[model samples]
Target: MDRTVVSVLFCFVSYVFQLASTEKNVYNFNGGWETDESKMLARPGICNIDVVDVSKQTFSQKHFEDYYAYVKPVIIKGSTDNTKFRKLCEKTALLERYGDKIVRLSSANTHSYSKRDVELKKYVNEIMKPQTLDTLGNETYYWFGDNDYVEFADLFDQYKAPPYKLPNMHGVYSFGLAAAGTGVPFHFHGPGFGEVIFGRKRWFLYPPEKQPSFNPNKTTLHWLMEEYDNLHQLDKPLECTINEGEIIYFPDRWWHGTLNIDTSVFISTFLG
Candidate 1:
């Protein structure tokens, strides 16, 4: 090869490597890269519910207040047209394109067992039915893995931040096929704001105060199972069956769990 051609090729390779490095940083650090001045500003008022179209308005403090009040953990009838959202949810272009890059959960470790332990495992098994425990355990539960930017870029571009804000709001959303006889273990979000659950399962909500000993930070996988055993001792926990077209907003810092009595697909969006 000519000396000049060799030098040019080396320079081109170096530039390509630098570009790849920068792209990696941008995707991995998305949650920390952007901070908004509005998030830090304080607004005072107990959260309440106002019947407003979420699709039309940007979620503000007033909306948050209303959401905290009547709608939090309560079903919002006609909140979203199921037909429209269903199309978005069913689009498999992104998943098909980036499936190999996505990460799966490690299922090797089995935590301590409780009375409810069998139910929790059974639920997970049902979702990934026909697949062995090892395969399901290794599957990823989160839609946005380390490279979430690639996974959800198109969806974010179309919908924007009104529903799913990135970085600051954690942009945590998940979709799973329904599993009969399975339920999520009781748990609470730490810096929890609210969650919108859409599915065909029966969801149960419990106030944080009711589960006095439940630790949001330290509650292990096994602890959630144990919590279910104590459910009979407490007053009937608020129970609601979540269905398509209905969005349930459960406020932050509340202890909640779900039991999927029938097979269904569910999506949960967390908002701060």
Candidate 2:
């Protein structure tokens, strides 16, 4: 063979080998966290067990010691009065001023304003547009309207029991409003707290143990939807149509989502 031809062949082979090496590194970097497999296993004893009814019992230190390690989530009812809740809901001056604008979930269903729901439908329609998922970043946007967070904190301050300190900071206690004929996209809470949904909406909760397998490096929403779709049959979700003054507590790491049956406003508090 000619020397020039031999040199060209050698260069081609070297280029191909370098490309393969780059691809392998990329795969390994992405898969390293996913493949360990054991972290995803559900730890059954980590949640604090307490009665869901506030009239019955509040979450005490004793309750935390006994069941906190084993129970993953708990929902509490009868935590506050309706009149106070209504007052907070009515205090959405910022939201009303913002008109129809919000940060929306990626790939969510688009709602129409003229769908016979109510005036709130226009606001809902504006917020549910598609966007890309950036890992749970600190960028906060209004789910309902601008004042939603303010109203939510006010309600949380009034309703949360003693020792459940309301944060002096904004966004600690937040409000979400869902219009009729829509739902919040599936998602999980951030670290250090669970969520309390206050309103008359149907909520669905999925436990990690119920999943086929677990992947701890990933968020709860990923596992919950995977199991929910594959299982085909939903375990009867803890469904509650919370009234004006009622609140439901879901412990941290509990996978939850909601659908709005009616135009609803809710205040969610995250307790550390």
Candidate 3:
């Protein structure tokens, strides 16, 4: 290579790195990255009821049958076996062990693909809170997900995970916690199951064949407050409220969103 060309390339790479460093210092604090302020969001149609709940005593292969045969969602009451996690999931227990660790928090707004990092103790004791009438998603509630798989493995090591999974698919575990009224917005990926270990959660789902018409910038809280009840009777979604010890199964490519009805400790098994 020509010496002049090599020198110019080196200079360009150095400039790019310098620019990135400057931006990081200007825009972030406490191991942070981007905030939802500079992100886009989504609009929505509505929420309705169309999910099944089965008791653990009667839970069967038929539930699995329905899950795959119809690609329908099901809530299996008393289905979770997270005995150890339940004991270790309380605020004090988590803070005692993982307080100083850094966690990544995704904005709980539709299509707002931004994340920030903060200490776990700060989120538990300072940031997360139950929603009050005065505040909604606009106040910036962050949803914690995939908090360093390796770093937190010990925490989940004794957790008895959901027994059933999509056939022939490998299950990858993700654990998360969020404040009341906070949740991930509409999105879809490979099949998965989510279980709330310590609080209530409300889910809104749409099958893969029926793509929901929604704004890309609205948060789930905003949609729930403004559009959920007003949705046309004919266009309602498959909705369900799951309590602790219940698990919800959603199929591949299905659009689903969740709202924690309480400060929630949850885990998911994503099949791939």
- Note the clash tally of each candidate: 10, 8, 9
Q: Which TM-score value belongs to model 1?
A: 0.47
Cα displacement (Å) at residue 18, model 2: 82
- The alpha-carbon deviation from the true structure for residue 237 of candidate 3, after best TM-score superposition, in angstroms, is 0.7
In model 3, which regions exceed 4 Å deviation? 1-63, 66-70, 131-141
TM-score of model 3 vs. true structure: 0.74
Best by TM-score: 3
Superposed Cα deviation of residue 17, candidate 3 (Å) = 67
**Residue lDDT tens for model 1, 153-206:** 664344322242223456455444433333444556632222222324555566
Model 2 whole-model lDDT (C-alpha atoms): 0.42
lDDT of 3 by residue, 1-272 (tens): 99999999999999999999997564332112112322212222233443444542555666676645246777666655666777787667777889998888766656646777889888777787654435444456564565697778888686777667555678888888876666766888888888877766788889898877665456576667777778787778888777677788887889997777656788888888
Residue-level lDDT tens digits of model 2 in 1-272: 99999999999999999999997675333211121223222211112233366677766646643554235444455654445444444425324533343333222222221122223335444542221233211221225323334523444555444233323422355456543333443445532222323324455555655433333333233333455356444554444444344445555555555544334556565554
In order, the Cα lDDT scores of the candidates are: 0.42, 0.42, 0.69
Candidate 3's clash total is 9
Q: Candidate 1 vs candidate 3: which has greater lDDT?
A: 3
TM-score for each prediction? 0.47, 0.46, 0.74
